[model samples]
Target: MKKLTAFIMLIALTGCSKLSMDNYQLLKTGMSYDEVTAIIGKPDSCEEALGTRSCVWGDEQKQIKAAFLAEKAMLFSHQGLK
Candidate 1:
């Protein structure tokens, strides 16, 4: 029944927004900022410091955050995504 469960999940996720755990899982270290955006859509806002750019998608209650150094993803974290 794993296949059935997977199919039901796929159907549930079909038209949902890109800001999801699945897309977050797709993020990898060293991925470019543009590539990350291509998967998660544009970040709500971004900040730069110490030559690192930190971007966040969604809001405080539930968000995905990625830190890019030299425009490549160096770190990423998420909050309250199901």
Candidate 2:
């Protein structure tokens, strides 16, 4: 029973470790792709078009999308989990 309880606690803590507003605030316009990745870790996925790229982070319920132009972040937005 103690082992089971410990495992559950570990899972709960891990789930709560997703991106937060503090991490979002670290982003700034003109930051390079590598710089942004260093702050938020590698994006879960990415898309590109016409010299513009958008990277997505976090799970479906709560996520952030950052658009890059010329390999630098131009804008970003976030959605909270519901």
Least well predicted 10-residue stretch by lDDT in candidate 1:
12-21
| lDDT of the candidates, in the order given | 0.92, 0.87
Q: What tens-digit string does per-residue lDDT give for candidate 2 at 20-76? A: 788888889999999988877889999999999999998777888999999989999
Candidate No. with top TM-score: 1
lDDT of 2: 0.87
Steric clash pairs (candidate 1): none
Runs of candidate 1 with Cα error greater than 4 angstroms are 1-15
TM-score of 2: 0.74
- Per-residue CA lDDT of candidate 1, range 1-82, in tens? 9999999999987768787788899999999998999999899999999999999999988899999999999999999888
**Candidate with maximal lDDT:** 1
Model 2 segments more than 4 A misplaced: 1-18
TM-score of each: 0.79, 0.74
Error of 2 at 33 (Å): 0.6
